[model samples]
Target chain A: MAITFPVEASHILMFARAVGDPNPVYNPASAPGGVIAPPTFGQAVAQFDPEYHLRPKPGQPWFGSGKTPSGVDKAPSAGGLHAEQHFEYLRPLRPGDVLTVEIKPGATWEKESKRAGKLTFRERIAEYRDQTGELVLIARGVGVTTERPVDQG
Target chain B: MALSASRIKPGDTHSETVVSNLTRTQIVQYAGASGDYNPIHTDEVYTTKAAGYPSVFAHGMLTMGLTGKMLTNYVGDGRLLKFGVRFTNQVWPGDTLVATATVTEVADLVVKLDVVTTNQDGKDVVRGSAEARIDP
Candidate 1:
């Protein structure tokens, strides 16, 4: 899936606030060519992704209460979690620039976990480019979902 | 403020950050901003009653995002070539957070750092490393 975001001063400003960042550079009045965004501003663009799978779907329960987006129906627990994240920035991002991002599923792996029994890890990649098709940034998210942790004696 | 690529060294350590206390509002807003409504990071009801956590925890991305903010403070945005983190502890509301970077490598126009986040209690909540281009 692809994402198009018309970078706004509000998003840049509010995102900084959301993370409790008090940098004045994020304010348009302070920075050149409008303010630049935080490094992880790339992730905030996911809100516009129509196919984003983390939200509560019609059949999926909220807060992973019953069944999570992983299509697994299990009792609510703190099992599925974000394991790792990476971002490769090709250039600086600023308000008023339209960023087009293309996302694709990456690789998957599994491992044994003492807390969660068996764990399955999956990755998704996002490539961000400008309207001119110039590459800007690349982001990868790795998530871990617990299958069933066996009880230890 | 672009960092001087020539002055960087493997042992050099310089990182700037905007420290802030975790808040529920930020958690919910991040959920709206990031399209991650997992509830474990925002919903106190489901998180406490069902998940069995004492309260909803902060999103790992939020801490990582703050670390990104730290990078921007030094090199400006879009200069980072690589940044990553491993979660170590659950971030609770009211926790004080600071993201830091210590230089680990400086070679071939690239600077690598050992990044970490700690709470006001001085406990590490996240550990990982990042790499960025030293030249703008």
Candidate 2:
């Protein structure tokens, strides 16, 4: 099952500022078309409650990952590593435009850990769309979950 | 002088100054501030033998943050359009990163930059590209 999240322009602006991106395009009052959001603004979308828009319907336990940050794993292994990420922008996100994000799992696999434990790699693709169903952005991310014996020191 | 798209030829180079007497505390602060708590980045033991890394390293994004800072500061605001990076190498504690950019392509309103971060040893720590739209 797929999950969707709703985002506010303020959150994106905050994120862009946090990353030190001071581009005026992210400024609502200064942007050219009265200023849209940043090109990378789609990053704020999450598959879980911290950003989830609507709860999954009953019997959709697969979509609920029990508070995992990305909502892709119910119990993420210890020592998660950010592997890679890619983003594509289709249209500018404007202020007052609410984004509906749809997340789809891309792939999941296991490998011998590079850090002396087992590792699980998971990738997901998220699509951000505006109220009128205009595609705004597409984000693909890969995460690494590390597992080591609890008693191994 | 501002480096406008029209002024940059295909091999033009851009450089920005950076200083770092990086402390362990700064590393931890970046981890907390960014919510990226990978143990190898915060814990020394895990980074060395456990993670097979030479030593505790700074967050890739933290270094990217420095690049972002320079880009905005250079463009003098209201001109940058998009920026992103792919992490290539680890930046260890106490290493000062110098970020540089080279013009790859130029359009009427856009300039593409091949940006890179290098340590004092001249080793590239991170490499990426950025696009800035010159405001008329």
Candidate 3:
């Protein structure tokens, strides 16, 4: 699926406050311009609306059956864990700067396990770029979809 | 609190830090603030019976927040560049966890550290690595 989302400054401030990140860049009082979003604020970019945010739709491949309106949940396994996360910051996020988050399946590895019995593990990689088309940050996240019992030996 | 990188030694050990007890309120707050609403963290029965856990547990990221406190309190603010951790063991309520970090590698611009947190029973609850950038 191809879509674009315009990230607003308010969304960044709300997320930073919620996570207890006291960085001045993220605080309105500290930033005369606007709040500076936290490093993890890139994760919120995945929820942007296509029509309202993107330039155009270039029909892309649809992989999963279920999809969250935020476009983050595309797997049938309603369950997901932040198994691992890594971020590289290129520049700080400023207020009133809209962003585009291009998401795609990074890697899909299926394994045969006595416990998991044989399920697919998917890693969704999302990259965020500011309105100026400069890379802001990259977020790589892994989600596990298993049909086996939570307790299987 | 400011952490002095110069005072840290390869073998220097920190006094054990006890979390005292984990509370449901803490988990709920973490869920709301962190945007992680995984049911296992909030649903006790589901976690206990379905997830094969002893009880409802804390978010790995929430525990990471505690670990971040351990680092920023040691290495000073605005110095950490890249910090990462893997969830090896699960932490539960009433389990007091201790965090410790040791300098593994040092340089003019970067220093590497190995960090860990364990329960009173000596069971390792979390293990990870952190890095900080030092002034030249």
Candidate 4:
């Protein structure tokens, strides 16, 4: 899937705050070339993905609770877990740089764990390109679905 | 300011307390900012009763984001060439996280680092490597 991500200074500020980074570089006026988005800021592209399952969309039945413990009668035993994340940056992303993100399935594998039972790992690769079609960042993420909730002990 | 190759070498390490007494509200803040609204990270009721967890936990991306801050602070803004991590453990509320980056190599005007983030118990929560541009 592909989504358009318009990087904005306000959004960068908010993200910086959320991550507790008070660096002056994230502020446009404080930085010479303009605010540079944080290295992991590319993950924010999820906000633009209309079909992202983690986000609840209007008119759709969300698995999250509303009136009951769960909105769905049969909610999965547990949600998928993020196993790994990697990023390669060709250049810094600045405010006003509109990027087109293309995500593709990379690999799939399985493993057995005593803590979580069977783990099905799925890898996703995302390419972020500027409006001019220049590749700015490449992100690879791995998600795992566990047969049961991880043993906290 | 960017790090200079001449000023750094293998074995050099930088560490910072990335987050102190992590809060659920801050987790929600990350979810809102990152647009990842997974109930396992926010809705305690759903996570405890429906999902079968002690409580809601922080998003893995949130921990990555927090760790990135320490990296950028050490390497300088906009200097990262690569960053990656594997989620080793779940981060929960009230946990204090400390991130550390150790220089593993420095050459060709670039520095490679081994990064790790640990919770109050000193248990590793995220571990990986990063490369950043450096000045001669």
Candidate 5:
């Protein structure tokens, strides 16, 4: 699925300041793309996944969908965290650019870990294309869902 | 300034980023800027008193952003094509991080770099690499 949105200088400035980089480069007077977003800005675009587990379901808590407790009581609270991130830019992302992002599932694998045994790794890829339908960037997010801890704290 | 592919060498080293002033304020700003309002990164009370963690930690994306800053400063944003990183360790407030990217290859209009980010005690915090398409 693809989601299209317009890039803005204010978002770039906010993101730059949020990351502690107050360099003048984010200002329109300094660079192309109005406010040339940082290299890693691809992650900030909201993902478009109907089955996104992180999405807050109706009446659900802000952070939880009550899915963890439903998964299995044996499943420890350790859960999983962001394992890796990768981005490929065919062109610079700039303010005022209307881009469409296609989100799709990639490869999945399993690994044996001492802390969380039989960890499962899944990759989500988001391909961003500009208004001209040219591919501008590809961002891959790898999530490693940890197996239930042998010794739950 | 943008670094051209023809100008980079196999052994060229990019400038380094050593951010020692990691504070809760930066984390809060990151949470605000990134729209990643995960309480674990911003709310110290939720993390310490509620979640039972030692303290709030910086977002992984925040660290990745700093690494990008180092690369972009060395070679302007237009030339950067690929950047990737793996979260190796948790970064807590007050821990100084030193990030370095070294040129590994310069061929076919592309420059590859090997990146390593370490904490104050030299513990690896992030390990990854990046590839940028340089202009002639």
Candidate 6:
């Protein structure tokens, strides 16, 4: 699904703070071309994805805990685990730009892991275009689902 | 200031302690800012009891963001053309992370770098590469 992502200066500031980056370019007051977003700031498009499962929506049955240990009876074996992420920037992203994002499935594969049983990896590619439809960034992300939680020891 | 091809060699490196003693609150802050509220990253009850993990962990993107902080600080703002990474290990709370970028190549107006981020235990958590525009 395509989503509209309106990049805002406050959001850039908050993201920069969250990442613990004290760069002047991310500050609206110091940046010459408005506030330039951090490199991973494009990932925040999840906020605009109306159906992003990671976010808890109102009136919906979330998988996270509620009164019970879990709101759902059975958690799926395929859990969300990020394996890889890559971004190619056509230009620096600034607060004034409104982006149109489209995400598509890339590939799926499986592997055996001693630490986490069977691992299923899925790839997703997202393209962000500015208001004028010029490509701004291309992001490729790999997500993994383990049969079991990875062993810490 | 952006790196200059005249000033760097292939083995030249830059390192920074991207984060010291990471906190769960910082993890929560990342989830709120990045809009990825996976329970495994925030909800301790869901993470421990339901997810079968020892504790809520940091998002891979958060680690990438931390590492990117070091990269941008080294390469200068708005200089990156590409950045990529693989999450080799999970980053847990209280982990102090050090990120390093090594110049691998300098050609014309671009520089390629190998990026690695390690935890307090000296284990690589994120490994990747980056390319940035540079000056001659």
Q: Mind giving the per-residue lDDT tens digits that candidate 5 earns over B59-132?
A: 88888888888888777766788899998877888878878889999888788999878888888878899987
lDDT of 3 by residue, A33-137 (tens): 555555455555434533422112346422221232222233223244445555555655666666677777888887675654565778877677777888876
Give the top-scoring candidate (lDDT). Answer: 4
Q: Give the runs in model 3 whose Cα sits over 4 Å from its true position.
A: A1-78, A91-99, A111-119, A147-153, B1-18, B45-54
For residues A40-137, write the lDDT of model 6, one tens digit per residue. 99999999999888899898788888996578888754386999999999998988899999999999999999999999999999999999999999
**For residue B87, what is the lDDT in candidate 5?**
86
Q: Assess each model's interface with DockQ, reporting 2 decimals per model.
A: 0.56, 0.15, 0.17, 0.91, 0.45, 0.84
The residue-by-residue lDDT of candidate 4 on A1-153, one tens digit each, is: 889999999889889888999898787657676789998999999999988888998888888889997899899897799999999999999898999999999999999999999999999999999999999999999999999999999
Extract clashing residue pairs from model 1.
A91-B78, A117-A149
User: Which residue window of length 10 is worst by lDDT in model 5 chain B?
Assistant: B44-53
Cα deviation of B75, candidate 2, in Å:
5.3
| Error of model 3, residue B27, in angstroms | 1.4
Candidate achieving higher TM-score, 3 or 4: 4
Point out where model 4 deviates above 4 Å: none
Residue lDDT tens for model 3, B24-119: 767766665555555566666555544545567777666666565566556655456666666556666676777888888776657678888887
True contacts kept of 1: 0.72
- Full candidate order by lDDT, most accurate first: 4, 6, 1, 5, 2, 3
- Model no. 4, DockQ: 0.91
Candidate 5: TM-score of chain A is 0.77
- Could you list the iRMS of every candidate? 3.5, 7.9, 7.5, 0.7, 4.1, 1.0
Off by over 4 Å in 2: A1-80, A90-97, A107-123, A142-153, B1-3, B23-34, B42-56, B74-84
- Candidate 6: regions farther than 4 A off: none
Which model, 1 or 3, shows the larger DockQ?
Answer: 1
TM-score of 4: 0.98
Model 5, residue B71: distance off in Å is 0.4
- Per-residue CA lDDT of candidate 1, range A99-120, in tens? 9988899999999977667788
Report chain A TM-scores, every model. Answer: 0.80, 0.65, 0.65, 0.95, 0.77, 0.95
- What TM-score, computed on C-alpha atoms, does each candidate reach? 0.84, 0.60, 0.65, 0.98, 0.84, 0.98
